[model samples]
Target chain A: MGHVVIDVMPKTEILDPQGQAIAGALPRLGIDQFADVRQGKRFVLAVDGDVTQEHLAQARAAAEKMLSNPVIEDVVSVRVLEADGR
Target chain B: MGHVVIDVMPKTEILDPQGQAIAGALPRLGIDQFADVRQGKRFVLAVDGDVTQEHLAQARAAAEKMLSNPVIEDVVSVRVLEADGR
Candidate 1:
C-alpha cells in the first residue's frame, strides 16, 4: 500500500472569507505575529497500490474529483510514500 | 534552502464543525459517496537551511507555536525538502 498526501487550497483569485475570518481571530487567540492565515484542507489516504507514477496520477484525479473544488481551489501538492520491499 | 510542509488537524476528540459543515455540503456539491470530510490546514514554507534533523525539529516547534492550535489541534506531520548542494 501507498500513502497519498493531498493539499488543497483556495485559488488565489477567489475570496476566502473563511481564511480572512481565521486571520482576524488569530490575534485574539494569542497567535499575534501572524499577519494572515489561509485555511485549507489536507487529506492523507492509504491507497491499494505501490507508489508508482501511475498511482500518483490516479490519486491526483481522485483528489480533483472528490476532495477539492476545482472552481475555487487547487491541488497544491501530492506526495506518495512507499514501503521498502522485503 | 529547504521547504517545510506542515499538516495540522483537529484533535480527534474535538468536534470539527467546519469539517462537519463541509461534509454536509458535499452531496449538494456533487460529491456524494464521501460519508465524511475532515478539514485541516497545510503550510509550505521555505526555510534558509539544510534539511537536517535539527531543522525538522525547529520547524515542528514553530508550527506548534504559530501555525497550529495546540489545544484543539495537532501537527500531524512535518517534511523537510532540501535542494542539491551547488
Candidate 2:
C-alpha cells in the first residue's frame, strides 16, 4: 500500500491564534530561538496500491475542496509519502 | 531567515475521529481512491538566522515537550524547511 501526504496551512494573511499562542508560550519553556510559529494540518491518505499521479490529483482536489478552507487556508503541498515515512 | 518544520501525528493505536470523518466523506466527493486517512499537525518555527544543528535540537525539544502530547501523539519529524519551501 501507498499513501499520499497533504499539508494545509493558514494563508499568510490569515490570523493564526493557535500559532500565536505557541509562540507566546515558548519563551516560558526557555526555548526562545524562534521568532514566530505557524501551526497547520497534515494528512496522510492510504491507498490500495502505489500512489499514482491520479492519486495525487485526487488528493490535491480533496485538499482544496474538503481538507482546507480556501478563504483562510492554503493547500501548501500534496505529494506521495516517501518509503522511509518522511 | 530560515524555518524549522515539526510534524506531529496521533499514535497508530489512537483513534483519529477527524481523519475518520474525512475518510467517510471522500466517497461523497467521488474521490474514492483512498482507503484510510490519518490527520496530524504541522508546525513551522521561523528563526532569526540559519537553521543550525542547535536550532534543530531546540526544535526537537520543543516538539517533544510542548508541541505534542506524548501520551496520544508522536513527533514524527523535526527538520529545517527546504529553500524551495517543501
Candidate 3:
C-alpha cells in the first residue's frame, strides 16, 4: 500500500483569518515574539497499492482538484509517507 | 528567527468526518485506490528567535494548549520549519 501526505497552505498574498486568529492568541497565552502565523491543512492517505509514478500522479490530481483551493491556497507538495504500509 | 509547524490529527478512536468526506470524494474524482484518509491541521509559525531547545519547548507548550484538543485530537509533532530567517 502507498501512503501519501499533501500539504496545503494559503498564498502569501491571501489574508488568512484562521492564521490571524491563532497568531493573535499565541501571545495572549505567553508565546511572545512570534511574528506571523500561517495555518494550513494536511491530508494523510492510505492506498492499497505500490508506490508507482502513476500512483503519485493520481494523488496529485486528487489533491489539486479537491484538497486545496487554487485561487487563494497552494498545494505545496505531496510527500510519500510510506511504501511498506508502516 | 525560528520557524515551527505543528501537526494535529484526530485520535484513532475518534470519528473523523472530514477524513471520511475526503476519502468518499476521491473515488468520485476517479482516484479509487485510496482506502482510508485522515485529515489534520498544520500551523506554520514564524517566531522571532533562535531555534534553541527552549524555543521548541515554548512552541510545544503553545501547540498543546491551543492548537490541539486533548479530548479528541493529538498533537502529532512539532517541527522546525526554518532557521536564520529563511
Number of the predicted model whose lDDT against the real structure is largest: 2
Q: Residue B14's C-alpha lDDT in candidate 3? A: 96
Error of model 3, residue B72, in angstroms: 0.7
Clashing pairs in 1: none
Error of 1 at A34 (Å): 14
lDDT of 3: 0.81
In order, how many clashes per candidate?
0, 0, 0
In model 3 chain B, which range of ten residues has the least summed lDDT? B77-86
Top-DockQ structure, candidate number: 2
| Candidate 2 off by > 4 Å | none
Give the C-alpha miss distance for residue B3 in model 1, angstroms: 0.5
Predicted complex 1: CAPRI docking category: incorrect
Worst 10 residues of 2 chain A by lDDT: A77-86
Q: Tell me what TM-score chain B of candidate 2 gets against the true chain B.
A: 0.95
Q: Which stretches of model 3 miss by more than 4 angstroms?
A: A82-86, B82-86
Model 1: per-residue lDDT, tens digit, B16-40? Answer: 7876775566556454443444567
Each candidate's lDDT (Cα)? 0.63, 0.92, 0.81
Encode model 2's per-residue lDDT on B7-32: one tens digit a residue: 89999999999999999999999999
What digit string (tens of lDDT, one per residue) describes model 1 on residues A1-86?
55656678788788877667755665564544433445577865544555567656755765788778999988877665324200
Which DockQ value does candidate 1 get? 0.20
My TM-score estimates for the predictions, one after another, are 0.57, 0.97, 0.88
Q: Rank the candidates by lDDT, best first.
A: 2, 3, 1
- Misplaced by over 4 Å in model 1 are A1-5, A10-40, A43-73, A78-86, B81-86
